[model samples]
Target: MDFWNRNRAKLAEKRRLRAARLQKKSNPSSAAEYQEKCKEASRTYNAKRLLAFKKREKRAEAAEVKHGRKEANRRQDQRETARDYKVEYELMKSGAEDAFRERVMHAMWNPAPGEYRIQFSDGSYKYFD
Candidate 1:
């Protein structure tokens, strides 16, 4: 068993050395080829980055759209609230003014023109007459 393990380790080391030698036997490339490979890698990296950026931008746009809709709805609700308040204010003002006018009319019931008098229903003349 010890010998088998030693042989296995040696075989693995030899295989690794042979693979390294094969890599060392590769053909050399020109500067132009190296630059072209660099450019290709850069292009691939930039394409991936651009795709991620576009996805992020799309998500941001969708969020903005949702926020815009929410804001629009909120503004609409505010407007409706303001309109209702205005209507209620107008109604209250009109009712108060009507009551004031009625009171004024009741207090100024002189039978003759330009005479601030008070003639009772019993035909009695008061001090205001």
Candidate 2:
């Protein structure tokens, strides 16, 4: 078995050498042609790779936009839901809230910019500006 393996390896090596010699026998022009062919093949491969990458990028961009739109819609929906809840709460608390507003509005006064005064229910007075 060892001999057989060694002999097989030798045969493969000889074949490889023979193929190399055959390739080296080409004239300079043929060599240049071979190089040009290799370059063209490489160019074609690179172009295909670039096209695939661009396609992936386009898909990614589209997904991002779709996700962004969904997020925007979600945020808007949340805001609307919150507003609806706020309206319901306000309607339930309308009398108390309105009374509080009136009391606060009557108690507090803004005489000027950055100036305010608060009036207590008592007759006592304090000045602030």
User: What is the lDDT for 19 in model 2?
Assistant: 86
- Model 1 worst lDDT run, 10 consecutive residues: 100-109
Ten contiguous residues with the weakest lDDT in model 2:
120-129
Output the number of the lDDT-best candidate. 2
In order, the Cα lDDT scores of the candidates are 0.64, 0.68
- Candidate 2 residue pairs in clash (backbone atoms < 3 Å): none
Clashes of 2: 0
lDDT of 1 by residue, 16-106 (tens): 9888656655634544566688899999999999999999999999999999999999999989866744543453346565643333323
Q: What is the lDDT of residue 26 in candidate 1?
A: 64
Candidate 2 lDDT, tens digit per residue, 1-129?
Answer: 699999999999999988875785666776777789889999999999999999999999999999999999999998986674455345334546565444433334466775434443444333443
TM-score of model number 1: 0.42
